[model samples]
Target: MDSNSFFWKIQAGTAATPEAVKTLGGKIVRVDAEQGSVETSFEGKRDFTNPTGAIQGGFLAAMLDDTMGPALAATLNEGEFAPTLNLNVSFHRSAVVGPILGKARIVRRGAEIAFLQGELYQADKLIASAVATAVVRKQAKAT
Candidate 1:
């Protein structure tokens, strides 16, 4: 490992699940292994609409989770995974079905724990933000 290649491990099929990337509709704009950050852009499809005609909050959380989780994951070595212990999200505006953007950063990471922050943007507006805590540990690879 070159010390700055953690993110590539995920991209190169060495860690995590396929759904971690697939659920975003196959859109990953950037991954910065050296900075421990990841960025994503996705379409807020019509299938995610709530009864009142707004995008549901859980979907937003999923986007935030995927973004922040990978930011933490990109820092871990092979055989290591970070599972979310808790995630706190705040909604700023009602997001409709449209283009959505997300960016996450690993704030503080220790031996056992890591802190992450993420922001969701739509039309250049800050719509949602999240802070997450996760545990880093080695897990058996699925067969």
Candidate 2:
């Protein structure tokens, strides 16, 4: 199915499957969706200067992984899903405490594989970029 249809299906409860949604300490919010990508946001209270204020590198990796998985799923046929095999992220600058948006987009789709690109942004500023490889799984036939 197309991305729009897939999005609608997930939103309408006819399809879309979500893994989890959580609010980590320090204005960090994350959501994992079944159809396409995971997204996380920071409320801007966390800064990088202070010892406890810094946004850890692991957190950044998690955000990218989450976004990449679902992006691959978005391009799948019904009952199909994608799992990440590899991911890489580059941080451009420190993310402020304000609202941050992470979006993942699929760049390549194949029968059993896909490539996805993700970006984390704070308002108009680009904070990070990610690329991932996903393994697409075919849906089992209903008996």
Instruction: Give the range where candidate 2 is weakest over 10 consecutive residues by summed lDDT.
Output: 20-29
* Per-residue lDDT of model 1, residues 55-107, tens digit only: 89988889898889878777777567788999999999988999899999999
Looking at candidate 2, what is the lDDT of residue 17?
49
What does candidate 1 score on TM? 0.86
How badly does each model clash, as a count of residue pairs?
0, 9
- Candidate 2, residue 50: CA error in Å? 7.8
Measured against the true structure, the TM-scores of the candidates, in listed sequence, are: 0.86, 0.66
> In the order shown, what is each candidate's alpha-carbon RMSD?
2.9, 5.8
* lDDT by residue for model 2 (1-143), tens: 55444433764568634443233222213433344454545444463224656466656666666556555654566666677888888988876555667777677677787888888777678888889888877656679
Model 1 misplaced stretches (Cα beyond 4 Å) = 1-10, 13-17, 141-143
| lDDT score for residue 12 of model 2 | 58
- Candidate 1 clash pair list: none
Highest lDDT: which candidate? 1
lDDT of every model, 2 decimals: 0.81, 0.62
RMSD of 2: 5.8
